[model samples]
Target chain A: MTATKEHVTIKGNKDGLVFLFNDHCEFPDLLSELQYKLEKSHQQILSGPTIDVHIKLGERELDVQQEEEIKKLVGHHGNLLIQSIESTPKEQIEKNIHQDLKIMNGIVRSGQSIHEDAPILFMGDVNPGGMISSNGDIYVMGALRGLAHAGKNGNKDAIIAASYMRPTQLRIANIVSRSPDESANEGAYMEFAYLDEDHMQVGKISELHKVRPVALQF
Target chain B: MGEAIVVTSGKGGVGKTTSSANIGTALAILGKKVCLVDTDIGLRNLDVVMGLENRIIYDLVDVIEENCRLAQALVKDKRFEELYFLPAAQTKDKDAVQPEDIKKIIESLKPDFDYIIIDCPAGIEGGFRNAVAGADRAIVVSTPEISSVRDADRVIGLLEGANIKNPKLIINRVRPNMMKSGDMMDIDEVCAILAIDLLGVVPDDQQVIKSGNIGEPTVMNPTSNAAVAYRNIARRILGDSVPLMNLDGKKGVFNKLKKIMGIG
Candidate 1:
C-alpha cells in the first residue's frame, strides 16, 4: 500500500498513547495496519513498563469478538496494555466535540453541590440551599429553586433552562442575578435564563427557537 | 438482633439528647431493655438530660480505651429498671474514638439490650459519624425553622450516603399557632422539604424545658403534651402504626364542632 493509504494512526496523548482507526476501512485491513504500525514501533513502545493503549474506533462500534481479536493482536506485539476502547457514534462525535454532558437523576438537596465541566441535564428538583455549576448550559427537568451557575468557564453562550426557574440565585459567566422581588409564576411552561449583553435575561423557552433580526449595519 | 437507633440532629439545640433519653425510656417502659449511648464525647449531654450525670464513673471513652469494661460504663436509670445510660467523656474530643470503636461497643451491648439508642452529636463531623456507625436505623430531629430543616436535609443525605436507608424524621418544637398563622412552616411543609417519613411531631410545649431543667425527659410526665408525642414516636419506632399527633391540640374540640356543624 502507498503512504497515502493510511488507515490506522498512532499518537501520544495526555492519557497515554492512542490508536486511531479509520471508519471506512475493513476490519481485516484495520487489523493489518495496526499490526504493521505496532511492528515498526514495537521496540520503542514496549520499552516502557506496561503502557496503556487507548483504542479509538472512529464511527465504528466494536463487538465482543472484535474487541477480543484486537486484544489478542495487541498482546502478540509486546507488553503493551489495552486500557480502554472508545467507540464514538458519528452524530455525537460531530455534535459535542468539546462539550461533555452529564445526565443525573435525583433531587439535589440542601447543602449538596453538583459541578460539571460541560453541560448538565438534571432530572430532579434543585432544592433551596443546593448549588449546581456547569461550564456550559444546564437543563433541569424539575424546579430550579437553588443556586445555578452556568457558563462557569466564562462561556457566556451557556444558558440555564428549567421547568420552574425560581432560582435563589442565577449566574451566567461573570454576571450574577438574584430572583426578582416576586418570584416568577410557576406554570407548565419552561423558562430559560441567558446572558443579554452585560446583564442576564430570563425568557420563555420558546424564545430560544425564535430568530432575532440582526441590526442592519450601514 | 437488637435494633440500634441513633438520634441525630445536624443543628444543635434541636433536642437530640432529649429524644434519645425519652425514646430509650419509652422503649424501656414498653417492656424492652434499652441502653442510651451518648456519643457526643466532648460536649456530652445525654447523661445530664437522662439525670444520670452524677452517676457516670466510666464514660464511653473508658470502654473503648480499655480503661474499663463496657458493663462498668453503663449507669442504671433510677426511674426505669431496664433503662440504662452510657455517658460520654467530656474531656476528650471526637477523634478519641473511631467509628469502628463505637461499632464494637454497640455490638457488645447488642445481646444485653433490646434497643440501643445512640444520642448523636450535632454536625456531620467525626462525632456524628462515630454515633451513626453502629446504628441500624436513624431518627433525624429538626425544628420548624428553615436553618434546622435545611441542616436536617443535609444530614438525611449524609445518612443515606452512609447506607442508613429510610431514616425517619421528627419535627420538634412546632408551634401550632404560628403554623396556623403561616408564620412557621407546618409539619407537612417540613416533611415535603425533607422528603422523609414523619415519625412524630412534637408541638412546642413549655413542659419540655421545665422537665429538662429538673434532669427529666418530658416522656416521664404522662400529662405533658410533649410526653404524649414522645410516647407516640416510641410506639412508631416499635413498628406500631400510630397516627401522627394533631399539633393543633384542638382535635377533640374541632371534631366535636365539625360533628355539630355536620361537616364531618
Candidate 2:
C-alpha cells in the first residue's frame, strides 16, 4: 500500500478472483496500483487454472478507453479472464433496461422464431413448430402449443408461462420436458413451467409468485 | 376489373391445384369470366386438373418470355365459354417466371376477366411467391390432418406478412367420421389454428379422386357433395350469403330423401 492508501485490492474465492478498486482514488492512480500489484504478485497466483476475475468499480465511473485499459492490464496476467465489470447505479440501470420485458403482437407461425436476451411477452398464439427463446422469462398471453426455451445459458431462474400451456416442448435452462400425448383440452387457463430441483414442473399461473418470487418483481 | 386470387398451401397434396380448378370452374359456372393461371412451373398440374393439358400449346413462360402473346397462350375451357386456362411450362423451373412478370400478366388479364385464379405450388418457395405476387386475395387450403393444418398456418402467416390480408381458409378433404371419433382434426380446430375466414369445407369424397383421374373437377358433378360445397364457396366469393354445408353425416339420408321426393 503506497502511503497507507490502498487503491486496489485482489481477493480470491472458490468462484474466482475479485479486483476491488477504491472509488476515492483517482482513476490513473488506481490503474497504476492495479498494474504494479499484478506485476509483483507471485507467478503461482496468476498461473493457476483459468478462472473468472470480476472487477468491482464501486462508485467509480469509467469511460470506454479506461475500461479497455483495465481489461488489458488484467488480461496480461496469466489465466485470468475478465468475466464482468460491475459498477453501481449506472450499470444496474443499464441491466434493468436490457432485461426489460419486450411485448410482441401477432402469432408466431410454424418455423418462425423469436430469440432475445430479455424477457418476452407474446400477445398471440405460438403455432405448432414455432419457437420462442430467451435468456429471461417468456410470457405468452395466447395459446402456446409450440416450443419454448427460457433461461437460456443456464439461467435456472427463468420461467415459461402461457395462457394455454399445451406446449409441444418446454426447455428451461439445461432441462427439457415434452407435453403428455393426451394434452387434455382443459379450458384455456394461464399456466407456467419452471425448473424445480433441476427437474421441469408445470403448475397454475397463480402459484408463480410463491414458486419464483423474482418473476413478480416486474 | 378482375381480381386475382392465389390458392396456396405450404404442404403438398393438400389440394391446391384441385381447389384452384374447382373454384375457377365454380366461378365460371356462376357466369363470371374467369381465367386460371398455373404458377407451379416445372411441376405444373392445374392444366391437368382442369383437363386442359392436351391443349397447352403455349405455356405461361411463353407469354412472359415474349415467345407468344398472353391471348395466344390461354386455352379456352371446353365446357365454359368464359373460362380460360393458362398452363405452366413443364420444362422450365420456377425461376422462369419472375414476380414482376406475374404482376404484369395479371394486370393485363384483369381488364378481360372477372376473376383470375392462380394455382400456387406447395411450399413457400419462389413459385409460391410468384403466384402470390399478383393476387389481390388468397385462399389457403388445408386438410383436417395435423400436418396440413400446421402448413396452412405457416402459409397464412406468410401471406399476411406479404400484405395479403384476410386470406380465406378452405378445410378440404374433411372426414366427419374421423373427426367425430377424435381421430382427425375438426374444421373448427383448423379454423381456430389458422385464424382466418372460412371459405368452405369439402368433405372427403371418393368422387374427388375419380373426377381428377378423368380430368374433371368435382364441382362439375352436380350430385357430388363436394360439388355443392364448392358452389357454395363460389357464391360466398361473390359476396352472396351462403350457409355452411352441414358436415354431420346425419343429414345425408335426409338430403337424399329430399332429392328423391323432389319436395313432392
Give Cα-based local distance difference scores for all models: 0.86, 0.88
Candidate 2 local Cα displacement, residue B32, angstroms: 1.2
Off by over 4 Å in 2: A1-99, A182-188, B251-264
Interface RMSD of 2: 0.9
**Across residues B16-43, which tens digit of lDDT does each residue of candidate 1 receive?**
9888888888898888999999999899
Residue B4 in candidate 1 has what lDDT? 94
Candidate 1 residue pairs that clash: none
Q: Which tens-of-lDDT digit does each residue in B153-180 have in candidate 2?
A: 8888789888999999999998888999
Error of 2 at B115 (Å): 1.1
Best candidate, TM-score-wise? 2
**Per-candidate clash tally:** 0, 0
Error of 2 at B231 (Å): 0.7
Docking category of candidate 2: medium
**DockQ, each predicted model:** 0.53, 0.52
Model 2 backbone overlap count: 0
